[model samples]
Target: MKLVSVETPEKSVCKMTFSASAEELETASNAVYERTRASYTIKGFKKGEADRAQIEADRGEHTFWYDAINDLMDKDVPALYDAALAEHGFVPVDAPVYDLVSVKKDEGFVATATVALQPELNLTKTTGFTTECVTPEVTDKEIDSVLERRRNAAAELVPHKGPAVKGNIVHIDYEGLLEGKPFQGGTAQNQTLQLGSGRMIPGFEEGILGHKAGEEFDIFVTFPARYHAKDLAGKPVIFKIKLIDVCVRQIPALNSDFAKKVANVDTLDELRAQVKQQLHDGKHASALNRAKDQILTQLADAAEGDLPSTLVESTYQLQMQQIQQQLQMQRLSLDRYLSQIHETRESFTAKVRTSAEKTARVRMALLQIAQQENLVPTEEEIDKQLAERAERTKKTLEEVKAQANVHAMRRNEGIRKAADWVIEHSTIEDK
Candidate 1:
């Protein structure tokens, strides 16, 4: 192989032209013929035994030319690109794009490979950024909220004979009619629904408010125009409700018995302490994450680099796929989610483009920092991470290995180490 010229026509993009020897071209052609000879037949030879010349004559001179050139390029271009990249001393962010210029039997082949390299940065300052870290505080309200949730979970429902209110479970038999005709899925017998839970239509819960048990009354409500049911959208429905029972939750007293039953703590004070500590730990973790994010953002903002479009697009698509997976887990469709967020596909992509570019830039900066600080993650670190991940996810080591992108994981560890280095080197103020 021979390198004709290497050019940097754009920031982060490297273009190289190279030529292969005729001998190498011939070898590649032979390899391609051997790989595909089973599908060819010649008059004087068996299917797989047909020689290259015979197949070419039977087909055309240009038949194997493209495949042969591709085979040679595929085998050689990446190495050639890597050598050029090494000479230039720049890391690539994306795979090289190859364009075959010419291919001939005796003249060999010429091709061009273009690649996107990590951009150079002129970081004003990687460190010495003054920032305040909030000391995570567990508020009394937060503790009360947790206690309320636990109390609600432990509560029992008892029959009540008063007007239905919020937090009360109402048992009712109802038949809904649209345009004076019964609609499908609009009738339920003795269904229990929590009032003011917003599980039903907007007005359904509100209409049931102040209604006592054993009352037969009509509740009028209109479905929203964006309702999932097309036929029922924006339609008025009258539900003839026969309230059978109203039940209110009986919460357990916040005593030692309650503490023992709820969280295995022997005393209420101990339970409160445990809850407060849990909340504090959670808040501290969240606050630390936010602080890290702020630091990264400041670093990224100060760091100057040309982002490769290919890497940006890849990051954007990966983010979108994650969003799709999350929506699927929530039993929602992407289209429905977009509608709820008041965004279109193009608009959402446009919005993601900005963050994607920033992410790519931040990743490159982190990698650069890792390299400068010699903060590469060791094999033992990776193994420990994988093991911990497998244990936490309840998956086998092999399963975790199969699902993980080794390159990304390594880079992640490197980034983590880089962040740690920055945190250690920089001064922090507690707020």
Candidate 2:
């Protein structure tokens, strides 16, 4: 394979004309024929005894060329691409899309490929930008909140004969009617609800308050104007409610025994200390994240380059896929989530594109810095990371090493080192 011509059709876009040698094409064609000859029965020749000329005459000269070209593409294009990358010094941001230009029986094939390339960055500022990250402090209130949650989790529910109150679970049967007629999705049996939980529409749970067990009553509620159901939006409805029973949570006492039972700590003091440390660690991580974001934003702002639309779109797609996976894990639909968040598709898309562009710019700046510094992970560093990965994943070091893509690892580590360098060189002010 050979690169005949290279052209930059647009910024961050490379168009290259390349070809497979005639000899290589002929060899591939012959191999294809040899593999399928036993199945081919020419007009005058028996199976497996047909010559290339005979087969070409029987079929077409270009009959086997397509598969041969595809085989060469699979076996040879990648090596050619790598060579072009080295010789032309163009970093590809996406896979090259190839188009066959022309092909002849003995003259091999000519092809053109277009690829999106990484923008050459000239960052005006690389260091000394100030980053603000506040050191987080833990307080007794936060610790108490954690303890309260633990108590809530350990609470037991007891039947209450009195009126339903906030934090009490009420079991009831309800049938809603619009203008004295039964409506769709307006009936439920043996349903349990918590008053003041806000799980139901406005005025529904509020009416349950002060209602005693065994009482049968009706509550009127007007659906919000923005309700998802168009027919029910802003409409007043009456729900016949039958109060079965009310249950109240009996919380345990906050003591050393409680601490030991809830958290495995010997005493309340020890539990508080543990909670405080956990909170402190979380705050520290949050602070560091803020610092990283600030530093990257500043670096990206200082960079001047053309961001490939393909790269940004790819990143956006990856981000969306990750969100979809997370939503699937939570058994939620993306459209429903967007509705709950009060976001429209167009607005959300615009926001995501902005974020993706910023991310692309930041990554490009970091990669350029890494290249400029000739940054690469050391063998010891690589081994240490591999060991850590093995430990975390419960795999053997040999298995982890076998699965590791060393080149990719080196590239990613180099980019990370560049990020660390930027952070280290920056002026970080802690509040």
Candidate 3:
């Protein structure tokens, strides 16, 4: 093969013209014939016995020509394209559309490709984009709430011989009636209810208050307007209640011994301190992460570049497909989902396009930053990433490599490193 010329008709488009030698094209044609000759049925010849010339004569003069060109397309064209781009120092962001100029048995073929190049960004304000971050303080009430949960977790259930009370677990047989008729999902026997837990309709649990085991009575309540079941919402109902049994919860006392047993701390004060510090640290880390996201978003928003239309369109299509797939998983139609989210098709499409454009900008900006700061991951890092992916998917490393898009993987990791770099180089101030 010979490379004739390389031209960039636009900043985002590359055009390359190349030709294949006659020997190469003939070899490819013969290879294609050899691979497909078994399927050819020639007159007075057994299957797979016909030579290329006989098949060609019976078929057409250009019978093997198209397949051979396509075969070269699959075999050598990509390497040539990459080599040409490398020599000229250009990286394509999207697939190329090719045009076949001419082809013949003697002269071989000449072709031209129009490729989309990745947009290089001139990134500004890559650091010190201030964002609001609140320093978290854990109140004593919050700490006490945590400790109270621990106490309840260690509580024991003990049988009660007499009347039920708030915080007592009760077993009962009952039927609920609306308009003097039993409704669907309104009857059960020996159903358990923890009084004051608010698990049942309001006034239903409190109705069991002071009722001893084996007592039978009727309690009335109305469902809340916002209830999930529309038929029952905001409707008054009568429940025939029978108390079968009751049990009181015996919660642990909050003390030094309780702290030592539950939290492995020497004293209650020490346990409180530990819980408070852990909560503050977790909240602080979350705040900082959100601030970092804001900073990078601003950086990408400030980045200057005209995104390639091909990349933007492809990304937009992919995102739309993904959204449609998600809607399918939820057993919904796209129109219905939009209605539920209060968006019309036009607005939704605009939103999707905006998001896709922003995504392209973010990627371009981060990659540029990565090039400038040397934050690109090494081969070992990529291998580790692949190994982690293999572990997560329960596949062998080789299988992961075979199925994974390695170039995308490298780009993603580099973008991630660049994002972290942007965050690390900036300071998030307290609001």
Candidate with top lDDT is 2
| Model 3 lDDT per residue over 128-237, tens place | 77788886788999999988998989998788987888888988999999999998999999898899998888888888899998889999999999989999999999
> Order of all candidates by lDDT, from best down to worst?
2, 3, 1
Candidate 3's displacement at residue 319, Å, is: 7.1
lDDT of 2 by residue, 1-431 (tens): 77788888788877888898789888888899888888888888878798888998989988678888899887777677778777988877556778999998668899988877879888999999897889778989999998899898999878998778898998999999999998999999889898888999899999999999899999989999999999999999999999988999889999998989978999989989999999998998899889888998999999987887767887788788888899899999989889999999899888888888898889888888988887767788899999999999999999999889765687678889899999999987877
lDDT tens readout by residue for model 1, 167-276: 89988999999999999899999898999889998999888889898899999999999999999999999999999999998999888999999899899889999999
Worst 10 residues of 3 by lDDT: 404-413
* Winning model by TM-score: 2
| lDDT to native, each model | 0.83, 0.87, 0.86
The CA lDDT at 193 in model 3 is 86
TM-score on alpha carbons, each prediction: 0.54, 0.57, 0.53
Q: How big is the positional error of residue 24 in model 1, measured in Å on the Cα after superposition?
A: 12
lDDT of 1: 0.83
